[model samples]
Target: SLILTESRSYWLASLTFLLLFSLMSFRSNKRLILTSAFILLTAGAVISQVPVLKDRFHSITDTKNNGSNITRLMIWKSHIKAFTEDYTLTERIFGAGDNASKLAWRHFGRAFQEVTGKEEIPPPGELRKWFHGGETHNLYLKFLTKYGILGLLGYLFFWIYVIYRNLERRDSLFIKAFVAGYVGFLVASFFENNFTDAEVQFTLFFILGVNFALISETAVRQR
Candidate 1:
C-alpha cells in the first residue's frame, strides 16, 4: 500500500547495506551475493527506461510530491497550529492521547480553519475526503504534539543510544549492516509514517533485534 518510491527507498537501502557487507566480508558466499545484487540492480535500472516506468525516476526528486506531499504539508501545518492554540496546558504537556492526532484534527477542525483563515466547515463526506487518515507525517512533530518536549527528547535520545550501543563494539558485518539500514530508515521516516505502518515498524524492530544479538555475542566472545 506504500508508494513505489517509498518501497524503493526501503529495499534499496537494505540492499545497499547488504552489498557493502558482502564487499567487506571474508566469507566464501560474499562473491555470490555481490554477483546477484549487481544483476538485479542493473536489470532494475534498465527496466526503469520503459515509457511506463520512467515517471518513477522523476518521483524520486519531485518537489510537488505527486500530490501526496502537498496534502501532507497541509496536514502537518494544521496539526502544529491545533497543538499550539487549541489544547489545554495538561493536554499540551501530555498530548491528547496515543494515536489521537486524527481525532484532534477532527475535534479541532474549527481551529484549523481559524489558523488557516478558512472558515467553512466541510460537509461530513467532504471531511472524509480531505482530512481523514492524516497523521503527523513527521515523527518529532507527532511526539511534540502528543507527549510534549519530554517525549520528544526521549524519542531523539533513543536512536542516539541505539547508534552508540552499536558503535561501542568493533564494527562487524552485522553491526555495519544494522547501522546502514537504520540510517536509511531514519531518513525515510522523516517523510513518511514508518511507525504506523506494520511492515515498516516490524522491519525496524527486526534490525534492532539483530543488532542486539550481534552485540551480545561480541561481548560474550570478549569475555
Candidate 2:
C-alpha cells in the first residue's frame, strides 16, 4: 500500500507503528525480537532494490524535484501566512469556523496579488482542489487554520487522554497496539490530513473503540 500510494508519510508511519508495536508486544521474547528485526531489515533491503520504489522513498527529502513535496510545503506556507497575516485576533484564537481556510487563503492571496500583481505559491484555485473539505495537508495546521489554537489544543488533549486511559492497563497488547497506531497516526498527521480522511478516520476510531473495550474487559476481570 505504501508503494502504491508512494506516500512518504505512509511509509514512515507504518515503520513507526510496526517497530513500536513489535518492541512493546515482544519485549520479553528475545527470539521474537530478533526475528522481527531481521524481517524489517530484509523488507527494507528488498524495497531499496526496487528502482521505482527506491526512488520514491529517496524522493521524500527531495523537495526541489518532488512536485508533491514542493506542493505540500507551499500549501503549509500559504495557509500559515494566511492565518498569521489575514486572520483577525478573534479568528486566531477561536478560528474562522469550518472551511474558512480557503476564505483566508483567498483573502490574503488576492490582496498580495493586487499589491504585487503576482499569484501566491499555491494560487487560490489550485489550493481549492486540495481542500477536499478543509484539508490543509497538515492536521495540526488544519486545526489551527479552521479551528484555531483552542481547537488544536482540544484535539491534542483528546489523544493524550485516550492514550493515558489505555496505558492504565498497560499489560494488554491490544491496548499497546492501539497506542502505537495512534502514535503512527500523529506522525502521519504531520504530512497528511489523515484525521479528515474518512476511511482512515473510521479505522482509527474503530481501533480506539476496541482499545477502550479491552480496557473495560480488563477492569471487569480485575473486579
Candidate 3:
C-alpha cells in the first residue's frame, strides 16, 4: 500500500522503521539478518521493476521532472523567508499565533513574484493551488510558523522525553518499536504536515499511549 501510494516520504519512513527495528531486535541473529536482507532486496527489486514506481522513485532526485518537488521547495523557501524577514521578535518567540502562515505568505508571496517576475496573486484559484492556504508541508516548519520558537522547542522536548522514558525502561520490544515509529515519523515530517494529519496522529498517539501503559506496568512489576 505504501509502495502503491508512490509517496517518497512514506517509502523512506517505512524503510527507516524496518532498518531500525531490525537492527534493534535482530542484529545478534545472523540467520535472521540474512533472511531479512534477502527479503528486502527481493522487495526492492520488484518495486524497481514496476515502471510507475520505478519512475516515481527515480524522480525523487530529478529536479527537472518533478513539479511537486519544485513546488515543495518554493513553499519551503517562502516559509523560511517569512520566518526570517516578516516575523516580529515577539512573534518569533511565541509565534505569530495559529494559522499565521496564511497571512505571512502575503509578504513572501510578493517576494517570490518579484524574484520570478510573475503575477502570482489574485486569481484565487492559482493562489489556493500554489500555497494550499499557507501549509508549510513540513511538520517542524509548521510548528514554528504556528507556535514560534518556544512551541517548537516544547514539541521537540516532548519527543525527547518520550524517547528517554523508553530508554529508561528498555526491556520491552514494543517500546523499541515505538522508538522506531517515532524516528520514521520524524523522517516523514520533513516532507509533510504529519503533525496535523489525523490518521498519522492517531496511530502515533495510540502507540505512545500503549508505550506509556507498558512502562507503567513494568514499573509496577518491578515494585
Candidate 4:
C-alpha cells in the first residue's frame, strides 16, 4: 500500500472480488452468501470505529484535519494554476513537455507558501533545515500538466478501449476479475500516483494480460 487511500481501495477491491468468487462458487446458496457478506461488513464497520482505527478511514473532504488529502488538493490546484496562469495558449494546448510534473511540484511548493502562508512553512532565511519531496499525486493531473488536454484525452481513450474490449467477454471469470482490479486502480489513482507505483502498475497490467489470455483461450475453444 503506497498510502491509506490506496490501501483502502485495494482492500475494498479484494473483498469485492472474494465475494464475487464466493457467489460464483455457491450458485445455489446466494441467500447464504448475501447474509454472510452483510454480517461481515457490519462487523468490519464496528471494528473500524474503535480508537485504534481512529484515522484509518479518513474523510475525503476533510479540510481541517492534518490528513494528506488537503495537501493533495493544494497540489492539484497549484498545478492547474501553474499551467493556466503561466503557460501560453500553445503551451496550454500542447504542454511544456518532459518532467513537467517535477516543475509543477516546484510550483506547488510556492503555491503552498502563498496559500497556507509563512506560518505553515518556515520563513525565508530561517535557520532550520527542511526535507521536502513533491508529486502531483493525481495521475490525471500529472498527465494533463505534462502533456496537456490532448494527451489526457488520448490516454483515457486507450484506457477505455482496453477495458471495453475486455468487457465484451462478460461471461469470462478472469475478465470479471480484471474489471474489478481495473476499477480499483481507477479509484485509487484519484488519491495517489498509482500509475507511477511499481507494485500497482505491475498488478494492473498483470490482470489485464490475464484477461487477454482468458479471452484468447475462450476464442480457441469456440473455434
Query: How do the predictions measure up, each by TM-score?
Result: 0.68, 0.83, 0.86, 0.72
lDDT-best of 3 and 4: 3
TM-score leaderboard ranking: 3, 2, 4, 1
Give the CA lDDT, 0 to 100, for residue 169 in model 3: 78
Task: Provide the overall lDDT of each model, using Cα atoms, as 2-decimal numbers.
Answer: 0.65, 0.75, 0.78, 0.63
Candidate achieving the largest TM-score: 3
Using lDDT as the measure, name the better of candidate 1 and candidate 2: 2
Name the top lDDT candidate.
Answer: 3
Tens-digit lDDT track of model 1 for 54-101: 665556555454555445556676677767667778777777666556
lDDT of 2 by residue, 14-102 (tens): 88888887878785545646766886787688678888888988888896667666556656666777887778888888987764656
| Candidate 1 Cα misplacement greater than 4 A, ranges | 1-44, 63-65, 98-124, 198-203
Angstrom error at residue 187, model 4: 0.8
- Score candidate 2 by TM-score against the native: 0.83
Clashes of 4: 0
Residue lDDT tens for model 3, 1-223: 6788989988888888878877877844456467658767976897889999898888878744476776676677777778888888888888877647665666655644644456845565665576766778788988887789999999999989998998887656777778888888888889998878789779878888888999999899999
True-structure Cα RMSD, model 4: 4.7
- Candidate 3 has which clashing residue pairs, if any? none
